[model samples]
Target: MAEPSLKRLQYFIALAEHGKFQLAADAVNISQPALSAELKRLEDFVGKPLFHRSPVTKLTAAGEALLPYAKSAVGAAHRFNEYAAAVNTGAPTSISIGTVATFLHRGLPQTITDFSAAHPDILVTTEEATSAAQSDMLLGHDIDIACGHMPLQHPGVICTPAARESFWLCAPTGSPITTIAEAVDSPFVIFRKSASPIYHDTVVGICRTHGFEPQIHHRTASWSAAVEMVAHGLGVSLVPSPVARNYHGDERLIFTRIGTRPNAPQAWITVRREDQSTLIGDLALGLVIASEALADPVAD
Candidate 1:
Protein backbone atom coordinates (compact mmCIF):
# COMPACT_ATOMS: atom_id res chain seq x y z
CA MET A 1 0.00 0.00 0.00
CA ALA A 2 1.12 3.53 -0.76
CA GLU A 3 1.93 5.81 2.19
CA PRO A 4 -0.11 8.87 3.29
CA SER A 5 1.49 12.31 3.31
CA LEU A 6 2.80 14.01 6.49
CA LYS A 7 0.34 16.88 5.93
CA ARG A 8 -2.51 14.39 6.11
CA LEU A 9 -1.03 12.89 9.29
CA GLN A 10 -0.91 16.34 10.91
CA TYR A 11 -4.53 16.98 9.94
CA PHE A 12 -5.44 13.59 11.37
CA ILE A 13 -3.81 14.45 14.69
CA ALA A 14 -5.51 17.84 14.76
CA LEU A 15 -8.92 16.30 14.12
CA ALA A 16 -8.25 13.70 16.80
CA GLU A 17 -7.28 16.40 19.27
CA HIS A 18 -10.13 18.82 18.53
CA GLY A 19 -12.86 16.31 17.57
CA LYS A 20 -14.58 18.75 15.20
CA PHE A 21 -13.72 19.51 11.59
CA GLN A 22 -14.11 23.29 11.90
CA LEU A 23 -12.14 23.50 15.12
CA ALA A 24 -9.42 21.21 13.82
CA ALA A 25 -9.26 23.17 10.57
CA ASP A 26 -8.66 26.37 12.48
CA ALA A 27 -5.97 24.76 14.61
CA VAL A 28 -4.07 23.47 11.59
CA ASN A 29 -4.74 26.59 9.47
CA ILE A 30 -6.51 24.69 6.70
CA SER A 31 -9.96 24.87 5.21
CA GLN A 32 -12.51 22.42 6.63
CA PRO A 33 -13.19 20.82 3.24
CA ALA A 34 -9.45 20.54 2.64
CA LEU A 35 -8.93 18.85 5.98
CA SER A 36 -11.83 16.50 5.26
CA ALA A 37 -10.37 15.64 1.85
CA GLU A 38 -6.93 14.97 3.30
CA LEU A 39 -8.39 12.71 5.99
CA LYS A 40 -10.36 10.93 3.30
CA ARG A 41 -7.17 10.32 1.41
CA LEU A 42 -5.57 8.99 4.60
CA GLU A 43 -8.53 6.65 5.14
CA ASP A 44 -8.22 5.40 1.55
CA PHE A 45 -4.49 4.72 1.99
CA VAL A 46 -5.29 2.38 4.91
CA GLY A 47 -8.37 1.00 3.08
CA LYS A 48 -10.53 1.46 6.18
CA PRO A 49 -12.87 4.15 7.40
CA LEU A 50 -10.87 6.35 9.81
CA PHE A 51 -13.55 8.65 11.20
CA HIS A 52 -17.28 8.20 11.65
CA ARG A 53 -18.30 11.71 10.59
CA SER A 54 -21.52 12.30 12.42
CA PRO A 55 -22.92 14.95 14.78
CA VAL A 56 -19.71 14.16 16.61
CA THR A 57 -16.68 12.77 14.81
CA LYS A 58 -15.41 9.54 16.29
CA LEU A 59 -12.81 6.96 15.39
CA THR A 60 -13.95 3.65 13.99
CA ALA A 61 -12.34 0.43 15.23
CA ALA A 62 -9.89 0.55 12.35
CA GLY A 63 -9.04 4.19 13.13
CA GLU A 64 -8.60 3.37 16.82
CA ALA A 65 -5.98 0.83 15.80
CA LEU A 66 -4.25 3.22 13.42
CA LEU A 67 -4.11 6.26 15.72
CA PRO A 68 -1.07 5.28 17.77
CA TYR A 69 1.05 4.33 14.79
CA ALA A 70 0.05 7.50 12.95
CA LYS A 71 1.07 9.62 15.94
CA SER A 72 4.39 7.75 16.21
CA ALA A 73 5.13 8.20 12.55
CA VAL A 74 4.27 11.90 12.68
CA GLY A 75 6.39 12.47 15.79
CA ALA A 76 9.36 10.64 14.28
CA ALA A 77 9.06 12.71 11.13
CA HIS A 78 8.95 15.94 13.18
CA ARG A 79 12.11 14.96 15.06
CA PHE A 80 13.84 14.15 11.76
CA ASN A 81 12.86 17.58 10.37
CA GLU A 82 14.36 19.30 13.39
CA TYR A 83 17.44 17.14 13.03
CA ALA A 84 17.69 18.01 9.35
CA ALA A 85 17.45 21.72 10.04
CA ALA A 86 20.30 21.49 12.51
CA VAL A 87 22.36 19.41 10.10
CA ASN A 88 21.88 21.90 7.24
CA THR A 89 23.00 24.77 9.48
CA GLY A 90 26.00 22.80 10.85
CA ALA A 91 25.08 24.24 14.26
CA PRO A 92 22.06 24.70 16.52
CA THR A 93 19.97 27.37 14.76
CA SER A 94 16.56 29.06 14.40
CA ILE A 95 14.11 29.02 17.29
CA SER A 96 10.60 30.45 16.73
CA ILE A 97 8.85 31.77 19.84
CA GLY A 98 5.17 32.58 20.39
CA THR A 99 4.30 35.02 23.18
CA VAL A 100 1.50 37.25 24.47
CA ALA A 101 1.59 41.03 24.46
CA THR A 102 2.00 41.19 28.23
CA PHE A 103 5.13 39.02 28.26
CA LEU A 104 6.39 40.61 25.04
CA HIS A 105 6.50 43.87 26.99
CA ARG A 106 7.46 42.23 30.28
CA GLY A 107 10.57 40.06 30.83
CA LEU A 108 10.58 38.37 27.41
CA PRO A 109 12.58 41.06 25.64
CA GLN A 110 15.38 40.82 28.16
CA THR A 111 15.32 37.04 28.10
CA ILE A 112 15.56 36.98 24.30
CA THR A 113 18.45 39.46 24.34
CA ASP A 114 20.34 37.41 26.89
CA PHE A 115 19.68 34.16 25.09
CA SER A 116 20.74 35.65 21.78
CA ALA A 117 23.95 37.03 23.31
CA ALA A 118 24.86 33.70 24.86
CA HIS A 119 23.99 31.68 21.74
CA PRO A 120 24.73 34.02 18.88
CA ASP A 121 24.71 31.15 16.40
CA ILE A 122 20.99 30.47 16.91
CA LEU A 123 18.52 32.71 15.04
CA VAL A 124 15.63 33.67 17.32
CA THR A 125 12.19 34.94 16.30
CA THR A 126 9.08 35.72 18.36
CA GLU A 127 5.44 35.91 17.26
CA GLU A 128 2.89 37.72 19.43
CA ALA A 129 -0.04 35.36 20.05
CA THR A 130 -2.72 34.78 22.64
CA SER A 131 -2.22 31.90 25.09
CA ALA A 132 -4.91 29.91 23.33
CA ALA A 133 -3.33 30.51 19.90
CA GLN A 134 0.03 29.57 21.37
CA SER A 135 -1.33 26.13 22.27
CA ASP A 136 -2.65 25.58 18.75
CA MET A 137 0.62 26.75 17.18
CA LEU A 138 2.64 24.59 19.55
CA LEU A 139 0.52 21.54 18.71
CA GLY A 140 0.86 22.30 14.99
CA HIS A 141 4.67 22.33 15.36
CA ASP A 142 4.85 25.97 14.19
CA ILE A 143 6.56 27.42 17.24
CA ASP A 144 9.51 25.95 19.15
CA ILE A 145 8.62 27.90 22.32
CA ALA A 146 5.54 29.59 23.86
CA CYS A 147 5.29 32.04 26.75
CA GLY A 148 2.02 33.15 28.29
CA HIS A 149 -0.22 32.89 31.38
CA MET A 150 -0.71 29.69 33.37
CA PRO A 151 -3.60 27.19 33.72
CA LEU A 152 -3.24 26.13 30.07
CA GLN A 153 -4.09 22.41 29.72
CA HIS A 154 -3.30 21.16 26.20
CA PRO A 155 -2.41 17.54 25.57
CA GLY A 156 1.21 16.97 24.40
CA VAL A 157 2.17 20.52 25.40
CA ILE A 158 4.25 20.89 28.57
CA CYS A 159 3.93 24.10 30.57
CA THR A 160 6.33 25.22 33.31
CA PRO A 161 5.43 27.93 35.82
CA ALA A 162 8.00 30.68 35.61
CA ALA A 163 6.82 33.54 37.89
CA ARG A 164 3.91 35.24 39.59
CA GLU A 165 2.86 38.89 39.25
CA SER A 166 0.87 41.30 41.39
CA PHE A 167 -1.77 43.76 40.18
CA TRP A 168 -1.57 47.53 40.72
CA LEU A 169 -3.63 50.62 39.90
CA CYS A 170 -2.67 53.07 37.16
CA ALA A 171 -4.46 56.40 37.63
CA PRO A 172 -4.09 59.74 35.97
CA THR A 173 -1.03 61.42 37.51
CA GLY A 174 -3.03 64.39 38.73
CA SER A 175 -6.10 62.35 39.71
CA PRO A 176 -6.87 61.86 43.43
CA ILE A 177 -7.43 58.10 43.05
CA THR A 178 -4.98 56.96 45.69
CA THR A 179 -6.91 53.80 46.62
CA ILE A 180 -9.11 51.26 44.88
CA ALA A 181 -12.09 52.72 46.69
CA GLU A 182 -11.07 56.20 45.57
CA ALA A 183 -11.50 55.08 41.93
CA VAL A 184 -15.05 54.02 42.66
CA ASP A 185 -16.50 57.14 41.07
CA SER A 186 -13.81 57.52 38.44
CA PRO A 187 -14.17 55.98 34.99
CA PHE A 188 -12.10 52.81 34.56
CA VAL A 189 -10.41 51.19 31.58
CA ILE A 190 -10.37 47.39 31.85
CA PHE A 191 -9.53 44.43 29.65
CA ARG A 192 -12.32 43.37 27.34
CA LYS A 193 -13.92 40.22 28.77
CA SER A 194 -13.95 38.39 25.45
CA ALA A 195 -10.21 38.86 25.08
CA SER A 196 -9.26 37.88 28.63
CA PRO A 197 -12.08 36.71 30.89
CA ILE A 198 -9.82 36.10 33.90
CA TYR A 199 -8.28 39.55 33.65
CA HIS A 200 -11.62 41.28 33.03
CA ASP A 201 -13.30 39.56 35.99
CA THR A 202 -10.32 40.11 38.28
CA VAL A 203 -10.20 43.85 37.63
CA VAL A 204 -13.95 44.04 38.22
CA GLY A 205 -13.67 41.88 41.34
CA ILE A 206 -11.01 44.21 42.72
CA CYS A 207 -13.37 47.13 42.41
CA ARG A 208 -16.37 45.28 43.85
CA THR A 209 -14.26 44.30 46.86
CA HIS A 210 -13.64 47.99 47.43
CA GLY A 211 -17.44 48.37 47.95
CA PHE A 212 -18.41 49.89 44.55
CA GLU A 213 -18.62 48.59 41.01
CA PRO A 214 -16.22 50.31 38.66
CA GLN A 215 -17.71 52.84 36.29
CA ILE A 216 -16.06 51.29 33.28
CA HIS A 217 -15.23 54.02 30.80
CA HIS A 218 -13.26 51.95 28.30
CA ARG A 219 -12.09 48.42 27.53
CA THR A 220 -8.76 47.43 26.03
CA ALA A 221 -7.09 44.21 24.89
CA SER A 222 -3.71 44.68 26.58
CA TRP A 223 -2.48 46.19 29.85
CA SER A 224 -0.08 48.29 27.79
CA ALA A 225 -3.02 50.03 26.14
CA ALA A 226 -4.83 50.35 29.47
CA VAL A 227 -1.77 52.04 30.96
CA GLU A 228 -1.56 54.34 27.94
CA MET A 229 -5.19 55.29 28.28
CA VAL A 230 -4.71 55.99 31.95
CA ALA A 231 -1.65 58.13 31.20
CA HIS A 232 -3.63 60.22 28.75
CA GLY A 233 -6.29 60.65 31.47
CA LEU A 234 -8.77 58.55 29.50
CA GLY A 235 -9.59 56.41 32.55
CA VAL A 236 -8.12 54.83 35.66
CA SER A 237 -7.14 51.20 35.14
CA LEU A 238 -5.67 48.27 37.02
CA VAL A 239 -2.29 47.04 35.75
CA PRO A 240 0.02 44.18 36.63
CA SER A 241 2.72 45.46 38.98
CA PRO A 242 5.54 44.08 36.85
CA VAL A 243 4.17 45.90 33.82
CA ALA A 244 3.61 49.03 35.87
CA ARG A 245 7.29 48.99 36.84
CA ASN A 246 8.89 47.67 33.66
CA TYR A 247 6.77 49.50 31.12
CA HIS A 248 8.14 53.02 30.77
CA GLY A 249 5.51 55.74 30.71
CA ASP A 250 5.81 59.51 30.97
CA GLU A 251 4.81 61.57 34.03
CA ARG A 252 1.15 61.32 33.08
CA LEU A 253 0.84 57.95 34.81
CA ILE A 254 1.00 56.96 38.49
CA PHE A 255 1.01 53.33 39.67
CA THR A 256 -0.14 52.64 43.22
CA ARG A 257 -1.15 49.68 45.40
CA ILE A 258 -4.81 48.86 44.81
CA GLY A 259 -4.93 47.07 48.22
CA THR A 260 -6.38 43.93 46.65
CA ARG A 261 -4.89 40.47 46.31
CA PRO A 262 -2.49 40.30 43.35
CA ASN A 263 -4.67 39.94 40.25
CA ALA A 264 -2.09 39.46 37.52
CA PRO A 265 -1.66 36.60 35.07
CA GLN A 266 0.77 33.96 36.37
CA ALA A 267 3.64 33.58 33.91
CA TRP A 268 4.21 30.24 32.13
CA ILE A 269 6.40 28.89 29.33
CA THR A 270 5.25 26.05 27.09
CA VAL A 271 6.92 23.66 24.64
CA ARG A 272 5.95 20.39 23.04
CA ARG A 273 6.76 17.60 25.49
CA GLU A 274 7.65 15.52 22.42
CA ASP A 275 10.44 17.95 21.56
CA GLN A 276 13.49 16.94 23.60
CA SER A 277 15.86 19.51 22.16
CA THR A 278 18.48 20.83 24.56
CA LEU A 279 18.38 24.22 22.86
CA ILE A 280 14.71 24.57 23.86
CA GLY A 281 15.56 23.55 27.41
CA ASP A 282 18.36 26.12 27.64
CA LEU A 283 16.09 28.88 26.27
CA ALA A 284 13.35 27.98 28.75
CA LEU A 285 15.95 28.25 31.55
CA GLY A 286 16.89 31.70 30.32
CA LEU A 287 13.25 32.80 30.59
CA VAL A 288 13.24 31.43 34.14
CA ILE A 289 16.33 33.48 34.94
CA ALA A 290 14.78 36.67 33.60
CA SER A 291 11.54 36.03 35.53
CA GLU A 292 13.43 35.77 38.86
CA ALA A 293 13.60 39.55 39.03
CA LEU A 294 9.85 39.84 38.61
CA ALA A 295 9.36 37.62 41.67
CA ASP A 296 10.67 40.38 43.92
CA PRO A 297 7.80 42.54 45.17
CA VAL A 298 7.57 46.09 43.86
CA ALA A 299 7.07 48.57 46.70
CA ASP A 300 4.12 50.92 46.39
Candidate 2:
Protein backbone atom coordinates (compact mmCIF):
# COMPACT_ATOMS: atom_id res chain seq x y z
CA MET A 1 0.00 0.00 0.00
CA ALA A 2 1.08 3.61 -0.65
CA GLU A 3 2.15 5.74 2.32
CA PRO A 4 -0.08 8.54 3.62
CA SER A 5 0.93 12.03 2.46
CA LEU A 6 1.93 14.73 4.98
CA LYS A 7 -1.12 16.80 3.94
CA ARG A 8 -3.47 13.97 4.91
CA LEU A 9 -1.74 13.47 8.27
CA GLN A 10 -1.95 17.21 8.95
CA TYR A 11 -5.65 17.28 8.10
CA PHE A 12 -6.32 14.31 10.37
CA ILE A 13 -4.46 15.91 13.25
CA ALA A 14 -6.37 19.17 12.80
CA LEU A 15 -9.69 17.33 12.82
CA ALA A 16 -8.73 15.41 15.95
CA GLU A 17 -7.77 18.65 17.70
CA HIS A 18 -10.77 20.76 16.69
CA GLY A 19 -13.37 17.89 16.81
CA LYS A 20 -15.46 19.99 14.39
CA PHE A 21 -15.39 19.64 10.59
CA GLN A 22 -15.74 23.37 9.91
CA LEU A 23 -13.09 24.34 12.49
CA ALA A 24 -10.71 21.64 11.27
CA ALA A 25 -11.16 22.77 7.67
CA ASP A 26 -10.49 26.36 8.64
CA ALA A 27 -7.46 25.33 10.66
CA VAL A 28 -5.99 23.47 7.68
CA ASN A 29 -6.90 26.27 5.25
CA ILE A 30 -9.28 24.09 3.26
CA SER A 31 -13.00 24.05 2.44
CA GLN A 32 -15.26 21.92 4.66
CA PRO A 33 -16.09 19.56 1.77
CA ALA A 34 -12.44 19.22 0.84
CA LEU A 35 -11.48 18.41 4.45
CA SER A 36 -14.32 15.89 4.71
CA ALA A 37 -13.22 14.19 1.51
CA GLU A 38 -9.58 14.06 2.61
CA LEU A 39 -10.46 12.64 6.03
CA LYS A 40 -12.69 10.08 4.37
CA ARG A 41 -9.86 9.09 2.08
CA LEU A 42 -7.57 8.80 5.14
CA GLU A 43 -10.12 6.51 6.90
CA ASP A 44 -10.35 4.40 3.72
CA PHE A 45 -6.56 4.15 3.60
CA VAL A 46 -6.57 3.02 7.26
CA GLY A 47 -9.38 0.51 6.38
CA LYS A 48 -11.57 1.79 9.24
CA PRO A 49 -13.98 4.56 10.17
CA LEU A 50 -12.04 7.44 11.85
CA PHE A 51 -14.80 9.66 13.26
CA HIS A 52 -18.37 8.86 14.59
CA ARG A 53 -19.90 11.78 12.51
CA SER A 54 -22.06 12.83 15.48
CA PRO A 55 -22.89 16.31 16.90
CA VAL A 56 -19.92 15.82 19.24
CA THR A 57 -17.18 14.48 16.93
CA LYS A 58 -15.25 11.54 18.47
CA LEU A 59 -12.56 9.17 17.24
CA THR A 60 -13.20 5.47 16.67
CA ALA A 61 -10.77 2.75 17.90
CA ALA A 62 -8.59 2.93 14.74
CA GLY A 63 -8.62 6.71 14.74
CA GLU A 64 -7.54 6.76 18.39
CA ALA A 65 -4.76 4.29 17.61
CA LEU A 66 -3.50 6.37 14.65
CA LEU A 67 -3.85 9.79 16.29
CA PRO A 68 -0.50 9.81 18.06
CA TYR A 69 1.41 8.44 15.08
CA ALA A 70 -0.27 10.99 12.76
CA LYS A 71 0.57 13.84 15.11
CA SER A 72 4.20 12.70 15.27
CA ALA A 73 4.45 12.38 11.49
CA VAL A 74 2.93 15.81 10.89
CA GLY A 75 5.13 17.38 13.55
CA ALA A 76 8.22 15.81 11.99
CA ALA A 77 7.18 17.13 8.58
CA HIS A 78 6.70 20.64 9.94
CA ARG A 79 10.14 20.56 11.57
CA PHE A 80 11.68 19.32 8.33
CA ASN A 81 10.09 22.22 6.48
CA GLU A 82 11.39 24.68 9.08
CA TYR A 83 14.87 23.24 8.81
CA ALA A 84 14.78 23.50 5.04
CA ALA A 85 13.56 27.07 5.25
CA ALA A 86 16.37 28.03 7.63
CA VAL A 87 18.96 26.38 5.41
CA ASN A 88 17.66 28.08 2.27
CA THR A 89 17.60 31.46 3.96
CA GLY A 90 21.10 31.01 5.50
CA ALA A 91 19.63 31.74 8.92
CA PRO A 92 20.92 29.96 11.98
CA THR A 93 18.36 28.20 14.15
CA SER A 94 20.42 27.44 17.27
CA ILE A 95 23.99 27.27 18.53
CA SER A 96 25.31 25.45 21.61
CA ILE A 97 28.66 26.70 22.92
CA GLY A 98 31.02 25.43 25.61
CA THR A 99 33.94 27.39 27.04
CA VAL A 100 36.30 27.45 29.96
CA ALA A 101 35.60 29.77 32.88
CA THR A 102 38.71 31.84 32.17
CA PHE A 103 37.64 32.64 28.62
CA LEU A 104 34.30 33.83 29.94
CA HIS A 105 36.20 36.48 31.87
CA ARG A 106 38.73 37.13 29.10
CA GLY A 107 36.63 38.28 26.18
CA LEU A 108 33.83 35.83 25.65
CA PRO A 109 31.06 37.97 27.12
CA GLN A 110 31.70 40.80 24.67
CA THR A 111 32.05 38.32 21.85
CA ILE A 112 28.70 36.77 22.72
CA THR A 113 27.08 40.19 22.99
CA ASP A 114 28.37 41.18 19.57
CA PHE A 115 27.44 37.84 18.02
CA SER A 116 23.92 38.04 19.45
CA ALA A 117 23.46 41.52 18.06
CA ALA A 118 24.71 40.41 14.65
CA HIS A 119 22.67 37.20 14.45
CA PRO A 120 19.66 37.78 16.60
CA ASP A 121 17.69 34.95 14.98
CA ILE A 122 20.08 32.29 16.22
CA LEU A 123 19.31 30.97 19.71
CA VAL A 124 22.59 30.78 21.63
CA THR A 125 23.29 28.47 24.56
CA THR A 126 26.49 28.50 26.58
CA GLU A 127 27.98 26.17 29.17
CA GLU A 128 31.09 26.49 31.33
CA ALA A 129 33.35 23.48 31.05
CA THR A 130 37.00 22.61 31.27
CA SER A 131 39.13 22.15 28.17
CA ALA A 132 38.81 18.39 28.24
CA ALA A 133 35.08 18.48 29.00
CA GLN A 134 34.50 21.00 26.22
CA SER A 135 36.42 18.74 23.84
CA ASP A 136 34.26 15.81 24.85
CA MET A 137 31.08 17.87 24.46
CA LEU A 138 32.16 18.98 20.98
CA LEU A 139 32.94 15.43 19.90
CA GLY A 140 29.66 14.12 21.30
CA HIS A 141 27.64 16.89 19.58
CA ASP A 142 26.53 18.25 22.95
CA ILE A 143 27.95 21.57 21.87
CA ASP A 144 28.58 22.99 18.42
CA ILE A 145 31.60 25.10 19.38
CA ALA A 146 34.08 25.39 22.26
CA CYS A 147 36.65 27.87 23.54
CA GLY A 148 39.43 26.78 25.84
CA HIS A 149 43.16 26.16 26.07
CA MET A 150 44.90 23.72 23.70
CA PRO A 151 41.87 22.10 22.06
CA LEU A 152 42.05 18.36 21.67
CA GLN A 153 43.25 16.91 18.36
CA HIS A 154 40.43 14.53 17.53
CA PRO A 155 39.59 13.02 14.12
CA GLY A 156 36.65 15.34 13.24
CA VAL A 157 37.56 18.34 15.37
CA ILE A 158 39.20 21.52 14.09
CA CYS A 159 41.06 23.83 16.45
CA THR A 160 41.97 27.47 15.82
CA PRO A 161 43.74 30.06 17.92
CA ALA A 162 41.29 32.71 19.14
CA ALA A 163 43.36 34.88 21.51
CA ARG A 164 46.40 34.99 23.81
CA GLU A 165 46.02 35.65 27.54
CA SER A 166 49.17 36.39 29.49
CA PHE A 167 49.72 35.13 33.01
CA TRP A 168 50.44 37.56 35.86
CA LEU A 169 51.86 37.16 39.35
CA CYS A 170 49.16 37.83 41.94
CA ALA A 171 50.40 38.76 45.40
CA PRO A 172 49.03 40.46 48.45
CA THR A 173 49.47 44.23 48.46
CA GLY A 174 52.53 45.55 50.41
CA SER A 175 54.21 42.16 50.02
CA PRO A 176 57.87 42.12 49.01
CA ILE A 177 57.14 39.66 46.19
CA THR A 178 58.02 41.44 42.94
CA THR A 179 58.76 38.45 40.69
CA ILE A 180 58.24 34.71 40.35
CA ALA A 181 61.67 34.19 41.91
CA GLU A 182 60.71 36.32 44.90
CA ALA A 183 57.64 34.09 45.44
CA VAL A 184 59.59 30.88 44.82
CA ASP A 185 59.88 30.20 48.53
CA SER A 186 56.49 31.72 49.44
CA PRO A 187 53.40 29.55 49.76
CA PHE A 188 51.84 29.27 46.29
CA VAL A 189 48.24 28.96 45.15
CA ILE A 190 47.92 26.83 42.04
CA PHE A 191 45.20 25.62 39.71
CA ARG A 192 43.91 22.11 40.26
CA LYS A 193 45.58 19.99 37.60
CA SER A 194 42.44 17.95 37.07
CA ALA A 195 40.40 21.06 36.38
CA SER A 196 42.96 22.83 34.16
CA PRO A 197 46.01 20.79 33.28
CA ILE A 198 47.41 23.31 30.85
CA TYR A 199 47.27 26.11 33.38
CA HIS A 200 48.66 23.93 36.13
CA ASP A 201 51.50 22.75 33.93
CA THR A 202 52.25 26.28 32.79
CA VAL A 203 52.48 27.53 36.34
CA VAL A 204 54.61 24.59 37.43
CA GLY A 205 56.80 24.82 34.36
CA ILE A 206 57.35 28.51 34.96
CA CYS A 207 58.27 27.89 38.61
CA ARG A 208 60.55 24.98 37.65
CA THR A 209 62.26 27.16 35.05
CA HIS A 210 63.09 29.63 37.80
CA GLY A 211 65.27 26.96 39.52
CA PHE A 212 62.62 25.93 42.10
CA GLU A 213 59.22 24.27 42.22
CA PRO A 214 56.23 26.20 43.60
CA GLN A 215 55.63 25.43 47.28
CA ILE A 216 51.97 24.70 46.53
CA HIS A 217 50.10 25.60 49.69
CA HIS A 218 46.70 25.87 48.14
CA ARG A 219 44.90 24.80 44.98
CA THR A 220 41.67 26.07 43.41
CA ALA A 221 39.63 25.46 40.29
CA SER A 222 39.27 29.05 39.14
CA TRP A 223 41.41 32.14 38.58
CA SER A 224 39.02 34.18 40.68
CA ALA A 225 39.45 31.80 43.56
CA ALA A 226 43.22 31.87 43.23
CA VAL A 227 43.16 35.67 43.24
CA GLU A 228 40.94 35.62 46.27
CA MET A 229 43.36 33.35 48.06
CA VAL A 230 46.18 35.76 47.27
CA ALA A 231 44.12 38.68 48.53
CA HIS A 232 43.53 36.89 51.78
CA GLY A 233 47.29 36.21 52.04
CA LEU A 234 46.69 32.50 51.69
CA GLY A 235 49.46 32.38 49.07
CA VAL A 236 50.80 34.05 45.95
CA SER A 237 49.40 32.77 42.67
CA LEU A 238 49.70 33.06 38.92
CA VAL A 239 46.59 34.39 37.17
CA PRO A 240 45.71 35.24 33.59
CA SER A 241 45.97 38.96 32.89
CA PRO A 242 42.41 39.10 31.65
CA VAL A 243 41.14 37.55 34.86
CA ALA A 244 43.14 40.07 36.81
CA ARG A 245 41.81 42.94 34.74
CA ASN A 246 38.23 41.75 35.09
CA TYR A 247 38.40 40.88 38.78
CA HIS A 248 35.81 42.83 40.72
CA GLY A 249 36.68 42.21 44.37
CA ASP A 250 39.59 42.54 46.77
CA GLU A 251 41.59 45.55 45.61
CA ARG A 252 44.40 44.43 47.93
CA LEU A 253 45.66 41.91 45.34
CA ILE A 254 48.43 43.17 43.10
CA PHE A 255 48.87 41.80 39.59
CA THR A 256 52.49 41.97 38.36
CA ARG A 257 53.93 41.07 34.98
CA ILE A 258 56.01 37.90 34.81
CA GLY A 259 58.76 39.03 32.42
CA THR A 260 60.39 35.63 31.98
CA ARG A 261 57.05 33.96 31.35
CA PRO A 262 55.81 36.52 28.85
CA ASN A 263 54.71 33.92 26.37
CA ALA A 264 50.99 33.35 26.96
CA PRO A 265 49.09 30.24 26.08
CA GLN A 266 46.98 30.59 22.91
CA ALA A 267 43.29 30.38 23.72
CA TRP A 268 41.81 28.04 21.13
CA ILE A 269 38.40 27.73 19.49
CA THR A 270 37.30 24.21 18.57
CA VAL A 271 34.47 23.02 16.31
CA ARG A 272 33.50 19.84 14.54
CA ARG A 273 34.86 19.68 11.00
CA GLU A 274 31.35 19.21 9.59
CA ASP A 275 30.00 22.36 11.32
CA GLN A 276 32.34 24.70 9.46
CA SER A 277 29.62 25.83 7.07
CA THR A 278 26.86 26.17 9.66
CA LEU A 279 25.97 28.78 12.24
CA ILE A 280 28.54 27.24 14.57
CA GLY A 281 31.23 28.40 12.18
CA ASP A 282 29.73 31.87 12.02
CA LEU A 283 29.69 32.09 15.83
CA ALA A 284 33.28 30.90 16.08
CA LEU A 285 34.47 33.42 13.50
CA GLY A 286 32.55 36.24 15.15
CA LEU A 287 33.94 35.32 18.58
CA VAL A 288 37.50 35.22 17.26
CA ILE A 289 37.15 38.63 15.66
CA ALA A 290 35.46 40.13 18.68
CA SER A 291 38.00 38.65 21.10
CA GLU A 292 40.91 39.98 19.09
CA ALA A 293 39.33 43.42 18.97
CA LEU A 294 38.65 43.45 22.71
CA ALA A 295 41.89 41.79 23.87
CA ASP A 296 44.11 43.92 26.06
CA PRO A 297 47.75 44.31 25.15
CA VAL A 298 50.36 43.31 27.72
CA ALA A 299 52.16 46.24 29.28
CA ASP A 300 55.86 46.82 28.52
TM-score of each: 0.74, 0.67
Error of 2 at 154 (Å): 0.5
Q: Kindly list the per-residue Cα lDDT of model 1 for residues 1-300, writing each as its tens digit.
A: 668888888898888889999999999999999999999888888888888888679888988767756676676577688779889877666778888777754578888888899889888899988776776676656677888764468566677776656678888888887877777788999988877766788778777777889999899887788888888889898877667776546688777765545445467888777664678877876776677566546443
lDDT of 1 at 282: 77
Global lDDT scores for all candidate models: 0.77, 0.78
Model 1: per-residue Cα lDDT at residue 144? 77
In model 2, what lDDT does residue 190 have?
Answer: 92
RMSD in angstroms, all models?
5.8, 13.0
RMSD of 2: 13.0
Error of 1 at 194 (Å): 2.7
Candidate 2, 94-207: lDDT as tens digits: 778898776776567877787889889887889988787786567646677888877578667688877665677889988999887798789999989988777888888878
Task: Judge candidate 2 at residue 212 and give its lDDT.
Answer: 93
